[model samples]
Target: MASRQTRLRVISLYKELHRLGRDYPDPSYNFHGKLRGLFEKNKDLKDEAEIEKAIKLGEYIRNETLALYSLRKYRHLKRMYPAVSPTDPFP
Candidate 1:
């Protein structure tokens, strides 16, 4: 049934979001709590269209979060190991 499919999709999204929350760097930000609150606030949504929209938005957020994390990681690596110039004898 459509409702069952929707339920599965929602659960999948919830699990993915929670997993990402675990990977987030800032514990003080309480990413998991905020993510849970966002879903809880919209738990009563009765319209399939609205639910789909929310799912899309959540996916977008997930992608953006991943990109930002990658960028941060890259910056950290760059700082830890700076580029060596050809003219420099030692790094």
Candidate 2:
């Protein structure tokens, strides 16, 4: 079980991620486009092995970008507010 501080931090992170998802016009604008462009430009990633590698790489990029954004927003909130009692469940 998380302590009150940890739980509050997690709840705050969720809220920020929700906000970012709504405010972000282009979800793929960050890593998806960049990685797709990278793969499209690469001539060597045409075969099955290379294609799989590209797909994995793209997935990694997307996950990493999302995780970074989540952490960034969490930090932003941590700096902005103190821990609350979490009156309601994380939305």
Candidate 3:
């Protein structure tokens, strides 16, 4: 099970990503690479508290990058899952 802070950070990241994804729609390696890097760096954090903090920051960065990258896609996404919307961009 994940820590409370980690879970909270994860949720925050999702929101941030969804918002960003909604503003900019694009499918580029650079965009994905940066998002992936954020996750990877967060995973590298050793201390639990530090990891949680990094996770939160990672989520923010990832969401912003994704949102910027997929703004158009995000707009169309609202039509699919109006409630959840871009929260699950893959869907």
Superposed on all Cα atoms, the candidates' RMSDs to the truth, in angstroms, are 2.1, 16.2, 12.5
Q: Write the per-residue lDDT of candidate 2 for residues 1-91, one digit (tens) a residue.
A: 3346644543454454445445454666663444445745753443655555654664564566578778878898898986766685663
Question: Which stretches of candidate 3 lie above 4 Å from their native place?
Answer: 1-5, 11-15, 25-29, 59-91
TM-score of every candidate: 0.85, 0.47, 0.39
Model 1, 35-70: lDDT tens digits are 999999888988888988988988898898899889
Candidate 3 lDDT tens digits, 1-91: 5677766766667556645544444455454456556666665556777866776666567755655557757777877864754778766
| Residue 67 displacement (Å), model 2 | 0.7
Clashing pairs in 1: none
Comparing 2 with 3 on TM-score, the higher-scoring candidate is 2
**Which of 1 and 3 is ahead in TM-score?**
1
> Model 2: residues >4 Å from true position, as ranges?
1-36, 83-91
Index of the highest-TM-score prediction: 1
lDDT of each: 0.87, 0.55, 0.62
